[model samples]
Target: MYQLLKQIVTTGIVTEPAPHADSALRQLEQRLSETILKHLGRALAIRHVDAGSCNGCELEIHATNSPYYNLEALGIKFVASPRHADLLLVTGPVSRNMEQALRRTYDATPEPKLVVAIGDCGCTGGVFGESYASCGRVANVIPVDVAVPGCPPPPTAIMQGILTAISARRS
Candidate 1:
């Protein structure tokens, strides 16, 4: 049971429920939403790197930007270089070839930055665990702050991951 709760974890790994659905919590949620909107007012600049994916996961990451689930509403935007990014969005199994690049990206991002590993392959190595060419997971290369799982999670879920990270820091 201890390992089950501590070592073994599901999809995202962390969750927090609002204290209530009543008036005060509702009001607080509204305030939180507004504050998050304000803090995230400027689109969160992000840098995305593919460690060694089969591309199935990358497809889903791209879908987050499609018209329907558009991540822009949360004021998140993908940037090119890690230096300018507030978040590092990593995907795929950790490939030996890209190991250095992943570290370089993480190094380039300034302090207080986050790494959101998207997909089970990126998080726990998923189907590609312990391969000759893979390090297995993203955390093996770079420390992960938040993990958004699925083969590739929906854009809304990605947003939730970001929000949760922000909320945890604030609290």
Candidate 2:
């Protein structure tokens, strides 16, 4: 016990240093907040749908909601129901089974809604193209306002896609 305490004392606090505040990211957050307010006049409510994915894009989306990206600070938040969402953030290749559900979700969202297709799968269907079991890209199932193409796009890219969708809506 004495030796263990001595070793702990010697090791002290061994941890990664806190991340530094990023001015660029802060600016982006501010811009997104303002743009969302201008276009929607309220916080952007998003509904995330996973048609059929290997979960890679979902992880990046989760990271976007984390403190580093601080998506909520940008006045964007995920909601449980499509009825309350201003945007639909769809991920993965559209599977045959989810086609009806995806369509229904899109239909449920009110007018002036936006859709951002995340990852290459959502954009171009990735490895699962149009097939008996797959419906190819998200656009195959529903209209997509913005397509963010990447095997699994980073959080910043996701944010950019959302911003693009909002900006395009005004024009």
Candidate 3:
């Protein structure tokens, strides 16, 4: 045990330096925080709805909340109830089963709400447009203020869409 401790003490601290922050990303986050406070007068609360996804977009969405992105630091958070949300982030195509639920959620949201359609499935229904089980795009079901199109958009894209929606609200 003494020899092991001696060996450990002999090895100096060896670790990589912390990664540099992206200036563009920091600017975006700062702008979003300022905009939300200016236009909405409070922190932005979002409700994420998965109509019928293969969980791809959800993964990207989750990444936005990680420490590196720190979405909460910019006064943005996800809520469980639509009633408490200022923005609705919807992903995936509107499936038959989730149509009514999505409508109800939209209806429950307060006035002057922002809705962002995430991913190709949520934007244009991807390859599952207007089918028996899928209802095409999110706009076909509920009005979308911003649409981020990708099979599973990156966290930055999702953040941009949210910012766009907030900007639209300002307008």
TM-scores for the candidates: 0.73, 0.76, 0.76
Candidate 1 vs candidate 3: the TM-score winner is 3
How much RMSD separates candidate 2 from the native structure?
Answer: 7.6
Where model 2 places Cα greater than 4 Å from the true spot, the runs are 1-37, 168-171
Choose 2 or 3, whichever is better by lDDT: 2
Tens-place lDDT per residue, model 1, 1-171, is 976776555433333322111121110122234455456446677788998888877787786777565666557788878898877888898899899989988998986576778788987899889777899888888877677777777656666665554452232
Residue 158 of model 3 has an lDDT of 82
Q: What is the C-alpha lDDT profile of model 3 across 1-171, one tens digit per residue?
A: 999999878865433222232232211223345455465534789999999888999999998887556666667799989999988999999998999999999999987577888899998889778889999888899977678888898787787777655552222
Q: Is candidate 1 or candidate 2 better by lDDT?
A: 2
Report how far residue 127 has shifted in candidate 2, in Å: 1.0
Clashing pairs in 2: none
Better of 1 and 2 by TM-score: 2
Better model by lDDT: candidate 1 vs candidate 3: 3
Show where candidate 1 strays beyond 4 Å. 1-42, 169-171
